[model samples]
Target: MASKESDAVRRHWATNRKAAEENRQDGDQELADHRWAELTTEPADVDYLAVPGRRAQWIVPHGAAADRALLCLHGGGFVGGSQYSHRKLFAHLARAVGVRALVFDYPLAPDHPHPAQVDDAVDTYRWLLDQGIAPEHILFTGDSAGGGLTITTQLRARSVGLPLPAGAMPFSPWVDFEATGASYDENRDRDAFFHRDLVRGLAWIFLGPDGSPRDPFVNPLYGDLTGLGPIYIQVGGDEVLLDDAQQLAAGAEKAGVEVELDVFPEMQHTFQMAAGRAPEADDAIRRMGRFARRVLELETR
Candidate 1:
């Protein structure tokens, strides 16, 4: 029942899982440092900002003004990952779309739960506003679990009467914490880096005893997304998160939000990270860059 392309991606992930596990045990701080080092070769016009309660980094395109900004959220479930791991990718994204990226160091779960990550995301937007960036000129982007957080934060922003962002992009988002998506089973054998069981295990850890895996913050597809900004979700047809992406796309459309769902036939989750080594990866990133460029141009007009 698995396509050849999907099967190949699964093989790649199976081979890479050991490395992912090692990185997990090594801790986010260590992984972030290593990822940052790898990104030194593709440096951005970097700047730092010290928020009263948190810190953030700005990756701007060279020779470009900071007229537009994308508040980036990096994913490592809810307890792992940091801005460092995503520095090069964000820098490239900033340059590719000719916009600045404001990557934040949001607090993780167990230590900070449910609303913490959500609140931190809202706080990052506020930080952007305080620095003179208009809310209409800002967008939000994230991957995997961070993708869910990005949407959750947007909801929280609305509840608190905060200004809405211009648009959003969630790459292979882990949107359905309940893990009931058809792709969870359909693509189980096809996906490489992530499987339903692996996600559930980590989700349980992050949610703790008091946390409900079904909570909208943890599972955004169940939430009300009405009146939200334009959203583009990219997912691999072979990914276990394929269902999460699909369900969210449907939910967003039902809520009347402008939504675009891109299902790449043979790709895997986070393939863009492997772009330098994979042609499919390059194509995916280019597609995303083009999408973001369109959004940016529309916002400017």
Candidate 2:
């Protein structure tokens, strides 16, 4: 049986689904920002710092390895999300992995559009590299749309001859811009948010008037996966995006890129947001930390 705390994610979405939709309709991001931050319990022994020359912040857990970094892309459907909203969540993961995290805000869609997010992501990555962090010591990670960026950023960076990170971890990634996944239908009743209509609307805004939903950088499921680092994906079993995780893993493996997929039964989208307050979320972070350590070639024993 799942722990009672597991239902917290489910309740969070179900309770806020209406308000979030209303916020979108009302053109307000403040509520969504506050709501997103409220999901995670503040982790102890983690310090936050502003990143110079960027709309980014560092989540430095006490005694974390100075040489390793977790580059996080905040997720809000490419339309919302920020460093402040995701700091606690990143802090929990950084603490678990024994490394520091850097989370940043990319321009939102319906205003900035495609390639803007990817450009910012690639730039942030390049900035990390410039900061003297070795590619082998950094891991690209994100949740939701940012999860999609975990793969797309590498594609964008590679096009410009940038070195790939050691690995990537995408939490409840929304990779299928086309929203053609069968899980959308299968998990419709189970998912409180993430209906196809909602995703289509967001994609339309994100892709803009000329953007192609099938474009490699916009929808990474259709992107080339060869030569990229290993991918670790985690999604809820009840999420409408379950197939997104499965499809991404398959694509990675087919291209000879290492992949690991974990579907947490009965959990909601991005359930890891409940870190520090839920056993399920804590377990997921631990698994992700282990994977990060192994791929980064850090001592795991």
Candidate 3:
């Protein structure tokens, strides 16, 4: 039931899988950006910015709320992805929510692994607080591996005594480092890329020699989920990670946290990357905006 534009996501992953299998993958840069570049119409209403001392870039939509921020940790299997690759995607979200967005970057795997990405995300978040953006006014958001980080980073920050943000919005999140989610098996043939082999390999690289894939800190599937902010999750129903979102929502709910999980049937992974070019993607963004606005206590117009 996906629209014609959905083909962009399919083609994007197909090309990535082809290159990866051939061992000719160009560090995953082109293929990763291709999803956003090919599917997203540039959001013309936002101004992109870089603070000299920060590890992130800002996508400030015109008339954005001065005190609110959406901190985006983009997805690239923890190996590759950056603000440059994700700016427009985040910009679209920022514009929808009427707030500024920070597209954060961290060192990639095999070069910087494990706690490194978590540390970077925490540091950027604290820096946002230091810059006068209130913790209650912020939301953590991202896709794929970044979506997983949106959860893990909050756990790390809480361990170090930082106040939790207003909420988190994670879509197509890759949270089950063990890849134990049944959706992986169910959607294996449905998903052209991200087979168990590829995902498990990424998990090992992300964990590094000192980390453990099953450790709650790294995987979060076994971690305590208490005291976190409300969570809103979106996942392509066709994704191998579908159960990741389901299990995470169930875990958060069991922990007494608020959870809203929206599954887009027959959609490809990170299909929200198709925002502005696809109705399904736009609908997803609208839901995120509503959740963020309500959680942040912004007056809904």
Candidate 4:
């Protein structure tokens, strides 16, 4: 159960989220880009790499042996989001798991369109394998659209006989881009932000005319899931993406994948961002850190 302090923080974050979203409504892309840029840091612990295909960059955290590398994807409706936006979250994962992470920049839709993001994800994984990173030592992580990318990449990798990663973690993933789920409508008011209309708008822009919004690459739950590795996901009870999390879990179970899921009630999307003050956020981060550690340990052994 969450504590009273955590409850308060949740409320505060919810209130602040509304304000922030409204304030930056006109500058969504700019805000996301700025967040992506924030990933650059000092101490030289996490090295950055610029790879081919969609301005891809990797974040390598120090302390852990360089052998283990995490491929992280950032979320922004497949049009926005980058490594910089997820600095704190990924850095915490690196420090806690004692491993380096590579935050890849996948191509966004509308401009780059479908197959581009998935292709970039596959290329990045291949790059990791080429660098001699063992399949069992690599893990995939992402949030929102990036979360979708993580799963789609896994599917594509498996189809091509690429070595699967040790495990995968996706937080509040948008699994069904087709918007066929009921929660997409029901959770609109429950979640502080993330309305159905907005998601659909973004979807139309990203998927383009040639793309089938329901295609498994765009909507992971619609694909075949057999023979995938262990997986875990985190989501808030109030987020519009809630159905995506639940349905994905069910699909993973049907596919015979070892899957673990954590759901926090009354919480909003990616609440872990408020970790400094929000107890819920702090607890979620701790949970994610612990999950990463366990996955890496089990895979390494």
Task: State each model's CA lDDT, in order.
Answer: 0.74, 0.89, 0.87, 0.75
After superposing candidate 3 on the true structure, give the runs of residues whose Cα lies further than 4 Å from its correct spot: 27-36
Q: Candidate 4: TM-score?
A: 0.84
**What stretches of model 4 exceed 4 Å from their correct place?**
1-31, 35-58, 298-301
Candidate 1 lDDT over residue span 87-188, tens digit each: 676776666677778887788777887667887788778778888988777888888888887798888888888888888889888877667777877887
- lDDT per residue for candidate 3 within 1-301, as digits (tens), equals 8899877888888887897899985755666565456667888878988878766788999999988899999988988878888788889999889999988779889889888998999999999899898999999999999999999999999999999998899999988888888888899888868888889999999888888887776776678889889999999988998999999999999999999999999888899988888889999999999888888888754
Residue 160's C-alpha lDDT in candidate 2? 98
For 1-301, candidate 4 gives per-residue lDDT tens digits of: 5555445434644654677567745357666555433332222355656656545565556657677878888877887776666655676666656787887667877789888888889988998889899988888988888888889998888889897898888888887766767777787777765777767777888888888877888887778888788888999888888988989999999999999999998777766555545667667767777777777774344
C-alpha RMSD of each candidate structure in angstroms: 3.8, 1.5, 1.5, 3.8
Give a tens-digit lDDT track for model 2, residues 100-177: 899998999888999899999999999999989999899999999999999999999999999989989999998898
The best candidate by lDDT is 2
Q: Candidate 3 — worst ten consecutive residues by lDDT sum?
A: 27-36
After aligning candidate 3 to the native by TM-score, how far in Å is the CA of 159 from where it should be?
0.7
User: How many clashes in each candidate?
Assistant: 0, 0, 0, 3
